[model samples]
Target chain A: MIAENYSLTGKQILHFETFGFLVRRNVFSAEEVAKINGEFDRRRASILAEIDPEEKRTFTQWPTRNPENPFTASLLDDPRIYVPSEQLVGEDSIPIQSHCNSYGKSSGWHVDTFDRRLCVIKNILYLQPTTADRGALRVIPGSHRSPLSEDLRNMDLYGFHDDTSPFLNASGMRGEDIPCYIFESEPGDVITFNELTWHAAFGGYKDRRSLSYNFFTNPKADDEIESMKKIVEHTPANTQGLGTVGLEYHPNWLENADNNPRRARWINWLEKWGFTDVLNN
Target chain B: MSMLTEQQITFFNTFGFIILRKVFSDEELAIMDDEFETSLKTIQGERPDNEVPKHFNWSNLGPETPFLSLLPEDPRICETAEQLFGEHVIAVSSNSNRRVGNTHWHTDQSHPHSYGLKFAAYLQPLNSDNGAFRVIPGSHKQPFNDKLKHIEMHSSEITVPYYSCDSAPGDIVIFNFATWHSSFGGSTNRRMCTIDFYKNPETPEEVEGTYDQVIVDEKVYAKLRAYGSGFHPHWLANPQNSPRRQRWIDWLRKYGFVKSEEA
Candidate 1:
């Protein structure tokens, strides 16, 4: 159902970047998809190795457990997703957040901070069926173009955290704060939204089991894996998963959110390119 | 070469601008900088402020010549200009500002038409701390008919992210005539050389206006006139004396660009 309406224009593909969210008509094959699911187990093993014995139990929710993930290697081989993203984002757009997870698991609705100035064009492949009642993806569509917020409630759907918050500041993100596009999907569906999109995930159908994750445009063809590893190490590790990749620090725990200017820049870029609009709409 | 590729050319047509890097090489830049610096001395007395050290401007500098001669005879620049303007194009005014100052958002037609460059070719490196030329990319194609509102350093309402050439020295950036842009010289010092590159009026109607007055496409013309003088600043009564301005009427008369005005 998600694949029926999304299409990209030449100019839009070339320059119209929405909060770094981009859609690829098709990103994987049944076989390739299966392989990705296979990689999930491999990655889980790695995560297990990395996790401390005491925290290993907590790592069960980690996104890497799905090896047959379309969100990772499958899209790289599929040019449909990679080409447009490559064109819109500089040649440097690459897979930074490559893993698979379900709606109930995807954490946080804040903006991404990899290239703080980069409007995140995420290509997410839905390996499983999705439905709104099951808590599919939620987004603040059109909020990409909204002006930077002066207050958190005024900051659109992502909620506000004034300067005092340890992890995020409400006054940070720039552009419209409109709320729209909480995606409910069907299997084989792919979705992309702006970087500034205000979204959160919740309990979906107990049966909703799918693979999903984000990758960016890497024009330089630089090692996307290397960059993510570095980003993970360099940034304050205590941030929420998305914030850990750089937008806001662990907003769940910290009082003051990281209102870094770079974060705002990413938000602005999302709106400029039109990712805030629901692709089907 | 103009860093803008073919796809970029099309994107600029729609978005208004594109930012790229390293148009000029280090070797070529040294020569160009020295030539630009040397020309600055010739106009030294022409500028009133001796202390305004980094402030250099195009119309003031002279050898009574087009600044193009100063650029190293390189094929890359020529190739770039050819892609944008086509075969033989003239060199427009070359303005080099010495101080860290900003120009309000405006257009080029405000001044008497420029010489060699129709599109402005800019070069500089900018981060938030330093000033970078800001532009409203497609605003050139369509005017903001909405009320003219004062904007902060960055405003999405009236302006948008342009293809800014935020680069270090030796990098050459180019944008077309229809593009809207502004300069910055805030707390940071901005040393930049801006030269306009225009498509020859003799070539043809660039495109029909989107509605508007005059010969250009009505849509674009309306947008152009919408900015009214916003795009072009007003010239004082004493045209020959204003150091900041070019002697347009006089220059037009010399070049026979003007037949006569409706007095």
Candidate 2:
């Protein structure tokens, strides 16, 4: 089953390490995409009302907790991508923040592996067709291998400053303007990129949404199978009804018994994914 | 010398933060300035194809106008980073932009991360009017939502005419990768240079290139997955994003200096 549908191709792996991105076509069905989008709107309405835009900077980023109801089921049911995940991360990979992103939407960019020496991958499943007219995703091709500064890669991490003047342009995007490109698909266009690859939000209107999930593997885990087994236990049983939850789990859980090679790589990925508080938590 | 000494390392350990004063030299500043001049022009609106306009330009006037470079041709900057971070250090991200003309403000951790630090240096002496570096000490422990719900309901559009903020040029400011800060674009010309770094707390800062060797925990993976992709917040350029105190005042909380109940 693992070899049949999910395995990283040499070309894809190269793309991931060099540019920081890769693509998978038709990873989701149209109906599923529409279903998730509908639920997103329903929850977003209430979430948006809670915030007074003029006076707040941080919202509870991801929804606190939820179950696998119709909305969540739709959110998590991306058949095409999960199978592909086995190839990129490992044979037994599962969505890390499946419930939380539904509430937050829009993952910002940061260098994968935290630096060039580290290796990591980012996965994007267009549970829905994200078009430029509807906010297609944008990314800097080959950014992972660029001769640029780390700050340059993370420029958008703090936030995208819409301070571009009609007369003057905002600076700092080094590659092509379209480095950030739309993930073209019907519903399940699962694209994977280098974790360090520079990408951004593609511009579009409502329903231009997508589902993103990242996974990691210890390149040399003594017991990769055992560690993955523990992950399932940590997850809430019947994860059928949880909203997107950020800081899903903390680090340190895999220390000592796991050693650094594989275990250390897992922790490194955490820092790049924007879970800055992981260690502290 | 309120610099990032051994005690600062302990503070970073307990609270997850550290501060380093003007650790950069004048020559580094000049190189950063020259790079900013070139880099800014590279990502301008002229590049219609590029979608992520997450960086800015302006060496003549602005704080940290030039993005930080880990692979900068200038060996001094890299060597300094190596000295501080140890051989295992990696360039997480860098930026070059003009801060508030008089008072721009915001922290390093706009985006959440697993474990990292924001280390920066002022390339030019900043005019206090333009923007000086100041931090909220140990605010990293607080869980500020990515939504910025606690900040005032100001959009990312406010600028010069409506408000004022400033800073000093040569004075270096290095806060935690998670610390919150802001700067005002001074009316007078100002130039600032800085770079942010990320290292595994468990790994020695001096370890050479430790990025891919370690796998980011699934917790980190899941967080990014849930927060959406690196593109949702779209926080690139804008003066409205002044740092913390203004956020406190705008939020109208009981104490701007003290942590709140929600925090």
Model 1: per-residue Cα lDDT over B1-263, one tens digit each: 46355544543444345444566677766655676566556556554773344343443223333243333123544445556665545333334545556666665443223213232334445643356655553443422301112223253222223323345665555666544566655443455555544444441232111001122322333342211211111121332354213333344333333223410
Using Cα atoms with residue i matched to residue i, what is each candidate's TM-score against the true structure?
Answer: 0.37, 0.35
Each candidate's clash count: 101, 181
lDDT score, candidate 1, position A100: 44
lDDT of each: 0.41, 0.41
Q: Write the per-residue lDDT of candidate 1 for residues A171-280, one digit (tens) a residue.
A: 23222212224455554556665555445544443223444334444323346545534544543333243321112111221221345343344334333332222110
How far in Å is the alpha carbon of A39 misplaced in model 2? 3.2
TM-score, second chain, candidate 1:
0.57
What C-alpha lDDT, on a 0 to 100 scale, does residue A186 get in candidate 2? Answer: 63
In angstroms, give how far residue A156 of model 1 lies from its true place.
30
Worst 10 residues of 2 chain B by lDDT: B157-166
